[model samples]
Target: MPYLNAAAVKAQDSPGIISVGVLLLFILIALQILNVLRKILMWWIRLLWWVTVGAVLVLFASIIYQRGPEKTVEDALRGARHLSEVWWREYRRWEGYQNLQQQHHVGTSQKSWTSRW
Candidate 1:
């Protein structure tokens, strides 16, 4: 009978099998990309979550541990002013020392000393 032709049946089914295999390969690639994206998103979320937690902990602890708002602000202001003054003094000293070195030509490069002479 016409339906009993096994070779014809096998040939007809081969194309369908090939198409299914190709579709499966495409699905596998899509799944791999999806997994990679999920991992990256999870890592980023974890980093942000920890950073936020640390910041909140620091802020809350400072507020609870400090004596009062006025003390905190005053201390901060005082520290800032002291730091500014120290930096300014240090800068002036550094500039003055540099000027002295320039005048005396102490510890200068050979080329610069020769040029100066």
Candidate 2:
């Protein structure tokens, strides 16, 4: 019955309460460390994402360069000039053919009219 007094009860319970407080403090420290680790992990994930994006961009650019119409501005200009020249040559040839056909048709028509008369 003496141990049941208020002072004895308080003294007896103090050790358990102090131990619980210490345990809670350790848990708080552990949670803080976990939070820091989570932040670091997120940062690394973000960095990796950017690196992957950069790599994809490089790959896309290389593919486009490889498969594009012309490699450089100079090449494009040269291609355009060649195309224009070919077009002009074809146009002149077509015009010459048309002119020769007109001349042949006129000559035959005149001979036919003379022979008919």
lDDT of 2 by residue, 10-116 (tens): 85768887678789999999999999999999999999999999999997688668868455556667889999999999999999999988799787755545567
Q: In model 2, what is the error at residue 1, expressed in angstroms?
A: 34
Q: How many residue pairs clash in each candidate?
A: 0, 0
TM-score, every prediction: 0.45, 0.48
**RMSD (Å) of each candidate, 1 decimal:** 9.0, 24.2
Q: Candidate 1, residues 38-80: lDDT per residue as tens digits?
A: 9999999999999999999999678757757777778778999
Residue 90 lDDT (model 1): 100
Residue 13's lDDT in candidate 2: 69
Instruction: Show pairs that collide, candidate 1.
Output: none
